[model samples]
Structures are given as C-alpha cells and as structure tokens.
Target: MNKKAKIAVTRKLPATVETQLEELSDAKFNLDDTPYSEPQLIRAVSWADILIPTVTDQVNAKVINAAGPNLKLIANFGVGVNHIDLEAAEAKGIQVSNTPDVLTEDTADLAMGSFIMASRRFGECERMVRAGAWTG
Candidate 1:
C-alpha cells in the first residue's frame, strides 16, 4: 500500500482503530466528531483517494463530483448506504463499500437495554430528579 494514499475519515473512530489507520495509511481524521458541512465534504472528497464517511455524512452527487481524479473508493463506516448516492458514485466510477451488519449485536443490545430502562421508568425518574420533583 502506498503510504501517500490519502484517506479522509469523516468522524472520530475508536482510538485503537484511529491509531491503526494512522499507522497503515496517510489517514486524516475528524477528531472533533462533528458533522461535515457541504463545503467540508466537498473538500474532503477533493483531497482524499478514499473517504470513510459515517451515517451523518451525506455522500451525495455534489460530493462525488467534487472528488479528486485520484478518488476511487467511498468506504462508509456504518451499514446504511442510503446516505451515499450510489448511482452517482457508479456513474463516476467510484466504488462504494460499507460494513454491513456491523451494528447487529450492538443495536440489539441497545434495544434490549432501552426496553429494560423504559420498563423500569428510569427516564421518568431522571426527569423527576431533574425537575426537582423527587419526593424521596
């Protein structure tokens, strides 16, 4: 792999993963974890050979078009490719990839956790406390 191959990551990933990316390639990370604006997205695509966008980043036609000539891949961080314009990517000969089923177990665990929390009225209790309505 070319050490100069530029990879733009649109969100802050886990520290270990980010470290690996840094070690493996010329990875540019969005350490702030904020959603990229249209111009920022355009800039990222313009600069990167590959982009690692998350659910929050919209890889639309405009973004695809803004990609530099070297840009070849859009590797999404999440399972949903709906955020990306697949037709436009294909038209531009940019390959789009994603980690499908990546969140299956985590999503299920969160669902179950939320179910238990709701059943226990944990949110309501927190609200009560926040509102200074706790009697006990």
Candidate 2:
C-alpha cells in the first residue's frame, strides 16, 4: 500500500477543518502558542507535501526555494494572498490556493457591530457601570 502524503499546518485551525485533514492525509500541526519565524517556516516546508497557513504567515521566495522539491501545495486559510508571493511560487512550480468568501459575512458583521458600539459610547457606559455610577 502507498503511504499517505504528509502536510504541515503552520498555525492553529478550527477543529472541523483539522479533522477533515486528519482523515485525508498525514497532518502535522504546530501546537506552540508563539508564531513560527521565517527559518522555522522554511524548515517545515522542506519536509511537507502540502502547507496550510494563515494570512499572517508569509510564504516568500526564499521559503519556496527552501522547500527542497517535496512541497506541492499551499492552502491559505484566508482570502488575501498578500502574504504569499504567487509569482515566486509559480516559478518554483508550487500550487497556491486560498479560502475566499468563507469569512466575508462574519467579518462584515463584526465590523458593523464595532462601528455601532463605538458610535454609541458603549465603552463609556461600561466604564460608568464598573465605577458604580449607574443611577437607574
């Protein structure tokens, strides 16, 4: 029997997605609370057949070059690809992909809620309550 492909997850992800990957391939997840540095990220990519990363993690040309020919896919967790150098990845023959429209509604909702709260002086109300100044 052929062995399953190995993948490296560069950051923490929701359990639902992680479970899906666990069923599909050999997945290694980073458990440390701290983020991985560039050198550490390069080392992880060197051994992976696929890489799963977040928007904050940068996958640059140097990192792609250090992949050592085993790396195949990069699946980003966010819609933005600013952190990745697509041209460099293409030049190195690595496939790159991102999750689009997944969190659009949620992000917009949160932004609207924050705007409402700020405009209504919600922070002042909370501060007054904490200071025992509620006369009602």
TM-score, one value per model? 0.85, 0.90
lDDT (0 to 1) per candidate? 0.92, 0.89
Where in model 1 is the C-alpha error above 4 Å?
Answer: 1-3, 124-136
| lDDT, candidate 2, at 112 | 95
Error of 2 at 72 (Å): 1.1
Q: Tens digit of lDDT per residue, candidate 2, span 40-105?
A: 889889899999888878898888888978888999988988998899899989999998998999
Top candidate by TM-score = 2
Clashing pairs in 1: none
Q: What is the lDDT of residue 34 in candidate 2?
A: 56
RMSD of each: 2.2, 1.6
Q: What is the per-residue lDDT of model 1 for residues 1-136, given as tens digits with 9 covering 90 to 100?
A: 3457799999988789888888888999887899998899999999899999999998899999888998999999989899999999999999999999889999999999999999999999999999999999
